[model samples]
Every structure is written in C-alpha cells, then in structure tokens.
Target: MKNRRLSNLKYEITKNKSTLLAIIFLTLIILISIFAFLIPMDPSATNTSNILKPPSASHIFGTDELGRDYFVRTIYGGRGSLIVGVLAMIISTSIGVAIGTISGYFGGWVDNLIMRSVDVISSIPWMILVTVISIFLKPGLQAIIIVIGLFSWMETARLVRAETLSIKEREYVLYANSIGETSWRIITRHIIPSVFPTIIIAATSSIAGAIMTESALSFLGLGIQPPTASWGNLLQNAQSNLQSSPYMAILPGILIVFTIYSFNKVGNVLRVYLEPKVAER
Candidate 1:
C-alpha cells in the first residue's frame, strides 16, 4: 500500500547515520531542556557568600560573580537557547517551505516575485538587521528569536525552492498532473513529500546558525537581558573578569562550542546520507 511505501522510506531515512546523529543531538538537547525545569537550584538566586567559589562538592560548576551556581544557570540558560532555536526554526522553516512550495510549484511570475523578494532580503547582513531590530525592541529571548527567524529564512527558502522545482519535474509528478490531479493535491501529496528530506536537512543546519546568532546578539549586550542566563550573556558578563576568572567565560564558551559542534556533526551526517550518490555507493 501507499502507506507501507511511505513508512519504508521513513525507515530508510532514519536508519541513515546522519539522521541517527541528528536524532541523538536533538534528543539530548530536548532532555536537557526538560531537566532544566526539574532541577532544584534557583537560576537567578544570588548568594554573595558563595560568589566566585570554584567548582566544588556543593556547587559543581561553581558560582558566578553574583554567587549563582553556574550549573543551575547553565541548565536554565539552555532552556532559553533551545526554546528560541526551536521557535525560530519553526518560523523560518514554515515560511521558507510555504514560499518555496508556492514559487516552485506554480513557477512563472510567482517564482520570479518570490525569488526576487528573497534576494532582496538575503542581501542584507543578518547581524546588522538583528542589531537594528534589537535596538528598537526590548532585549529579550523572544525578540532575539524573532529577529533571527526573520532573517534566517532566506537560505531555507532558496534551498526548499530548488528542491521543489526538481520534485515538480519528476516523472511521478508529471504522471499525476496528466491524470488530472488537482494542483493542490499534487503539490501537497507529492511535491511536498519529495522535497521534505531537503527541508529537514536545511532546518537541522540552520539551528547551529541560529544558536550562534543568539550568542552574538547576547555578547553585544543587545541579546537576552541580565538574569536571563544565555550563554552569550554569560560571556558578556565574564568579559570584564576574563583575566582574573577565566573559568567564568570558558564554561559557557565551551558549551556553545560543543552544542554547535554537535549540531554540525549531525547535519553533515544527514547531508551525506541523504545524497543519492551516497545511497548508490
């Protein structure tokens, strides 16, 4: 049956090394996000007595300048980062997939208009755009997510559009069209499914970019406000004490590096597995 074929395709995709890695990375992050909520330590609690204490039996990651446990803050910080990343990805991918689907499937003036708009948006420097937006809006998690999501969609749009165009030209697509299937039906049932693998790949890749953007925004003091505990904001606070307390900056920096690296590794694996030549080989 059609359902069985679709299930098999999904199994093959999931069996891919890249897909497995991505799944693991995403799963770990999700679990961490959940754990942040369950932990006992107060992310914002400040105890001057415990300030700058090195990692010890009581406070594993040590306390910050404000005497808040770094471990607790890091976990709480992951909440914001992961939430923003997920929200931004949802927004970017939705907009990208929709615009790309419409443009590629319909083509003609629609394609020209969509692509031209994308080019115009893409020409702007993302960081500058984010900076401008941050200046006007309150510096917070939601604002950063919105700004990054808005600017990051161009790449996804371009990638999805290209995939859609190719899928629309496939023999199965042509056969469906020849059989007088409705345009919407063909696009939804056939075109979208065909391009989904590419979209998944692009979305995974974009998460790393989003995390970095959020960090940059936080580092510039235009990102998440004080007491929010983003990795970027943590680094911003540590800049003044980097010489005396290098551990302050190093901890968050290492987390950001590891997080981005994990996502990139997963994305690379997915890319390789999804390629036709790799499958052929």
Candidate 2:
C-alpha cells in the first residue's frame, strides 16, 4: 500500500512540472534548514567591518546593520520559521481532527454544542484575537504555537465535520454500525481514512498560514523575540534598514514569498491529486 501510494504520488508530480519544482526547491530549503549548522559562519556572529555590505562572494545574501551575515540569517531563519509553522499545523490538525471526529461522528446535542462553540471561535477577527491572546501569553515559540494552533483549527474542524457528515451516511458506515462495531473503532478504522484527503489538503494551506501568522506576530514584536532568528523577525529588523540596505528586507522577503508560494502550490496539487474529478479536468 505504501509503495503503491508512493508510485501514484510520483506519477502525479511528473504530470505537473511546477509541482515537481516546488517539491525540489522546498526540499533544498528544508535540507539547508536541517543542516544549518554546517554553514561555516554563525548567523548571529557580528562583524563591524562587514555590516551593511552587499551580496558578494564571502557573504552571499549580504550583511545587516549589525554586520550579521544575511545569508546565514536567512538559512537559519528557515529552521525556526518552518518548525513553528509545522508544529502549529500539527497541534491545530490534531485538535481539529479530534473535535471534528467527535462532533461529526456523533450528531445530536453533541454536534450542535461543539459546532456552536466552533462558530463562536471562528466568528471573531482572527488577527485581532491572536493579538489579544498574545498580549497575555507573551511572545515566544510555545505561546505562538498554542495561539495559532488553537485559533486556526476551526477551518480544519469545519472541513472534517462536513466530510464526516457525508461519510457517516455511506453504506460502509451503516454496515459497520449494523455489525455492532464500536464508535471509536468505526471512526478510527473507516471514517478517518476517508477524510484524510481533506486533512492533507487543509494541512498544506494551514502550514503556510501558520508561517505568515508567526511572521506577522514577530514583526509586530509580539512573536519570536530578538536575538532569535525567524523569517518574520528578520524582516522586522530589516524594516528600519530598508532605505540604506534594501537587501536586508529583500532577501528574507523573497524567501518568505518562495516558501509560502511553494506551500500554496503544493496544496493545490494535493487537492487536484486527491480529487479524481478535479484531476480529470
């Protein structure tokens, strides 16, 4: 099953050159982030003479006001940025899947109550909510993860709930119920698998959202604090220096664009791949 799935995924990627390129580029970025330590110079190392230098042989991306290497900062920044995004995605997805499963698998006062709660949470302006929450939670990695994860799960929940509603009415579901299978077993064995495509597609977009949110919060001085490098914080520091050293902002900005665009493209690809009707068109 795993091999067959891999084969299908390979075929799907081959069918779309853009998606393949996204995968390859993203893979390279991720590899750099993973092996960031391999880079010769430390990202945080300060050199008074090298500060504000343009992109060159020794310092590829350039240098910041603090004389820190922009290339190293950008590469190392990917680690924290991607980790937070991925972590937030996992937390949100887990909470969403659990709540959605319960809300969807069991319809009644349970669904109504849970769904109403979801409505309340989802109705608020998300960024304002995040800011308000950040004020109390303080700015850091864990706090950012929790806030983003908690708030962002609503979309996934709704999707999962809707998918569950449709799936529970299927013939196999009724058969499982008729055979006296436990609710947990039925949801775990049957329903969850059916809804996984929705989750995967949702997840691709959600990670990108998380990355943006984290960057925004950090940029506003409400997320990852200084001395720590995230794409967002890197951009934050670059703002004041934009006129004098535009590359400070430009490099990280380009990276953020590349990363987010890749994720979005990957999400669209997954959506088409999972939906046979869409893929046909």
Candidate 3:
C-alpha cells in the first residue's frame, strides 16, 4: 500500500499536461541534436545547381542561396541554439540561486550588496551589453552563451531570493535552527528544496528568452559566425532575396516561431502547476 501510494504521487508529478509537452518538445530538440551529427547531408555543402530551390524530395526544407540543404542546416543550427540556451540557463541559474539563497537567508549587509549589484546589472540594455562583449570577445557560440548567462541572471536571482526569504521564515526552518543544525545543513535540507520548484519553472521559461536573444544576435551578425548555421543566420540570408525566394527566409522564421511557442506553452503550464493559489478573504 505504501509503495502504491508513492507510485501514485510520482505519477501525479509526471502526468501534468505541461510536463508532458515539455518532455515531448525537449525530446524532439534532443533528436534534432543527434540528427545533426548523424545525418548525411553536409550542412556547408553548396550545390549551385540547386540554389534557392523550394522544398522537394531531395532537399526536404529546400536549399538556400549557397545551395545548402535547409533541412540539414535547420537541424544542425538547432543543435547550437539548444546547446547555448541550455548552457546559459545552467550558468545563470547556478549563480542566481546561490547568490539569492545567501542574500535572502543572511539579510542585512549581504542582501543589500547583492541586490544593489543586481540592480546595476539590470539597468543596462542586455542586447547592447552582449553586442559590446561580442565585439571584445570573438563572436561564437561560447561568447553568446556567456554574455546571455551573465546578463540574464538578475531575474532568476530576484525570483529565487523572494522564494528563499519566504521559506527561511517558516517554522520548520526555525525548528531546525533550534535543534542546532548547521547553517549550511538547514539551508540545503530546507530552504533549497522548498525554493527548487520555482527555480525549475523559471529555468524552463528562461530557455525561450535565451533562444530569442541568440537569434537576435545572430541576425545582427554578432552571433554564430559563418560556416555555422542558426535560425537567425538563416533569416539574415533571406533578407536580400526575400522577394524572389521568400521560402528561404520563411521556413527558418516559422521554425523559430514554433519553437518559441512550444516553450511558452510548456512554461505556462509549469507555472500554473507549481505556483500556489491564494485564497480570497
């Protein structure tokens, strides 16, 4: 009976529509990443013969100006985009959660210093900051990831700090402190676990934002240098020949829109499930 109850609880956590959609989309992205390495098509191969070709059996998503297969490029491009997004999320969330947890739990001077630093960073325009950094550093996947990760953490820090403050004030936390538990032990066992659900939901939502930021940077020629493909770079190519071969641009744009939409749907679902509903007085 106890085992059955545990299994049911696990099923409840996994069975939500948002969780399912997130899993499916994540799986699809992963498959695309693997396909990038396994697929036969040379993403950089140019077939002048098939230049600007529309979607056909031979070239699934058709060929671009350089006669490269759109389908293959899209898959390959997705690999880079997903990698940057995931890595950026990991970096930002780790830094944010640590700082937020410490600041909220300690309060006083520590909270003021961290919050003031966050405010300074938050005041700048993220895109411009990224662009400036990209200029100083080489423009590539790593550069974009670092830039986005650094700038994006403020929001996560603020969110985590708020959640941590609430959790730290709980009677359970006080009881653990009364029992002479070490600060680190109390924080890890109580505060972090309580705030983790919010962190997860926030992280999932941040991916969509990261993708858009990367796309914008790539579109501006400051992201993912040539010989590499991204949705943004693909769209950049489409700008010149938009009138003649709109498909060249439209396909990648469509994919970007769909990817962002999928992420938003999943994020919304998770937010609803994880957040507590307030009772009316």
In order, the Cα lDDT scores of the candidates are 0.80, 0.87, 0.80
Top candidate, metric TM-score: 2
Candidate with more favorable, higher lDDT: 2 or 3: 2
List clashing residue pairs in candidate 2.
none
- TM-score computed on alpha carbons, candidate 3: 0.87
Kindly list the per-residue Cα lDDT of model 1 for residues 1-281, writing each as its tens digit.
45654554466557656556656766776798787877877899999998888889999888889999988888777777777777888888888888888889999999999999999988888777877886788889889888888788888888888888888888999999999999999988998887776887778767877888888889898888888988888889888877767888888888788787777666555554455333321
TM per prediction: 0.86, 0.92, 0.87
Superior candidate under TM-score, 1 versus 3: 3
Q: Model 2, residue 137: what's the lDDT?
A: 87
- Residue pairs of candidate 1 with colliding backbone atoms: 18-269, 18-270
TM-score ranking, high to low: 2, 3, 1
On residues 1-281, what C-alpha lDDT tens digit does candidate 3 reach at each position? 45654454345447756556655876797787866777877899998999988889998778888898888898888888888788888988888888889989999999999999999989988777986797799998889899888888888899899988898889999999899999899878998888876788678767877888888889999888878888888888889988878887787787777677777666555544454342111
Task: Please identify model 1 stretches exceeding 4 Å from their true place.
Answer: 1-26, 269-281
lDDT of 1: 0.80
lDDT of 2 by residue, 28-137 (tens): 98999999998788888899998799989988888888899888888888888999899999999998998998999999999999999999988999879977887798
What lDDT is reached at residue 99 by model 3? 86
Residue 80 miss distance in model 2 (angstroms) = 0.9
